[model samples]
Target: MKRFIITEDGSHSLFSAQFNQQYHSLQGALNESEHIYINLGLRPALENGPVSVFEMGFGTGLNAFLAWKLADQLQKQVFYTSVEAYPVSMLEASQLNYEEATGEKGFMQLHHAPWGKETGISPFFYLRKEITTLQDFTPDRFFDVIFYDAFDPQAQPELWTEEIFTKIAAQTKPGGVLVTYSSKGIVKRALAAAGFAVERHKGPGRKAHILKAIKL
Candidate 1:
């Protein structure tokens, strides 16, 4: 079972008993999503007009919420597809404080959207939550951005391998970007091996660096 814990920034994240890892940063879940996923991934993708985004982990629905909120605020269209092997239960979802912080409605609807079919949650946001893992997922279309928000390499190294990223690159368009909070050397090597022109970016809070790998 997953348990919710309040982080340093007064936001709640799940502590996964199975993985023995937190779904997000204990420093601040909200800010972490905003910084790494939104500011880096979504915003840049929006520059190229309407965007199709693929996310690795749908964890707390926080990333989707932020994307939906930003798409609405920017008056841009977004088609978001997120893959997760395991989903958070309604009880765990209820304990999250993200909606309050974001001041955005429809978070519940995003979570409630039926898997395997694309659902229009808002005028600007269309979501398709896939109940699968990266290894098993096949893309329906190439994405403008990929939010590679999987667990740390220490916990789930298989997901961060070159083979997996090569699969990811196959579904990414030329110049499409993949962003993640990890700056580990092996991670960058894997990304490069998979055909991305990787760049390091300033990380949020105490994190030293984050990575943005572009398919060039």
Candidate 2:
């Protein structure tokens, strides 16, 4: 069963018994997403113009929500694609407090949006949520930014292998960026083996460093 827990920043995060992990950092779900994925990943990609983002996990919909909000704020168009094998139920999604915390409406709309089809969340943001695992996913288009938000190596080692990273890298445009809240040596090695120039950056709360890799 999955349950909600409040992080240090007072944001709601889901605790997954199946994965034996929480969707976001226990320190702060909102803070972690904004810092690693938004600040380090999405923001830089948008500077190049209209951006296409690919996310590995769409657990709480927090990242997508923030991306949509930022795209609207910047008046930049974003085509967001995310793949999730297991999706959060609407009941579980409704319990999340992102809308309340961010003072942003549309949290529910994101959850309510149909899967496997492009849904326009706003004039600036279009989302397509795929119901599949990373192993089975084939990219239809290359992406500018990839949010590698999978479970930790301890939980989902297969997803962290070089084979997986290579598959993801194959669909990333040259110079495109991929960000994650993990700096594990295996991850760095796998990304490097997959042809990305990896860099370590200061992480949000508790974590010492996170990784940002650019497709070569």
Candidate 3:
């Protein structure tokens, strides 16, 4: 398999590969994540203190990068836990040219952060990055927010099942939120069956909708 692929979407650039894909267009992905989840949802909650962010697919680390920047603004410590089965090596990882696409030097720093033997990235960000398949892993804590950024449910059917959502719900605090780009009936139903109060909200670019569930 190709280690890295610089794919283009119209005028937008996406760094893609076997494990991750990111729209390199200056916070295109980052902005969407921060705007919808953090700025609008998690930020309000973080006014009291720091927030712990758990992501299903860390992907290109774009979401983690955005969370780091948001943490600075909110003055909140963030604990990020993301699972990736295939992590791109540093050589291939460096091929991601988000800085060139976004004109921001900081975008590059997010991916370069140290990974834990099992538990954290840095003092400010606690990263429990288990470089293993999601199906084989389990959660450790009740997070404030969950970013379900896994690949499409059709491509990876097992990741979207009732059992998986049930596991995800187990790791969240009561009333915590889980946001995702999918609002399919099966997906929502699975989440509800697992005990979350699911809401279908408007998605970015696509007017259809997305899922925002509150833990009860």
Measured against the true structure, the TM-scores of the candidates, in listed sequence, are: 0.98, 0.99, 0.81
Candidate 2 pairs with clashing backbones: none
Candidate 1's displacement at residue 136, Å, is 0.6
Ranking by lDDT: 2, 1, 3
TM-score attained by model 3: 0.81
In angstroms, give how far residue 1 of model 1 lies from its true place: 1.6
Q: List clashing residue pairs in candidate 1.
A: none
lDDT for each of the candidates?
0.92, 0.95, 0.68
**38-61 per-residue lDDT for model 1 (tens digits):** 999889889879999999999999
| Candidate 1 CA-lDDT value | 0.92
lDDT of 2 by residue, 1-216 (tens): 588899999999999899999999999999999999999999988888999999999999999999999999999999999999999999999999999889999898889999999999999999999999999988899999999999999999999999999999999999999999999999999999999999999999888999999999
Q: How would you order the candidates by TM-score, starting with the best?
A: 2, 1, 3
What lDDT does candidate 3 reach at residue 204? 59
Error of 2 at 44 (Å): 1.3
Better of 1 and 3 by TM-score: 1
Q: Name the TM-score of candidate 2.
A: 0.99
* Per-residue lDDT over 51-96 for candidate 3, one digit per residue giving the tens place of the 0 to 100 score: 7777887667667766766676556788788887766556654666
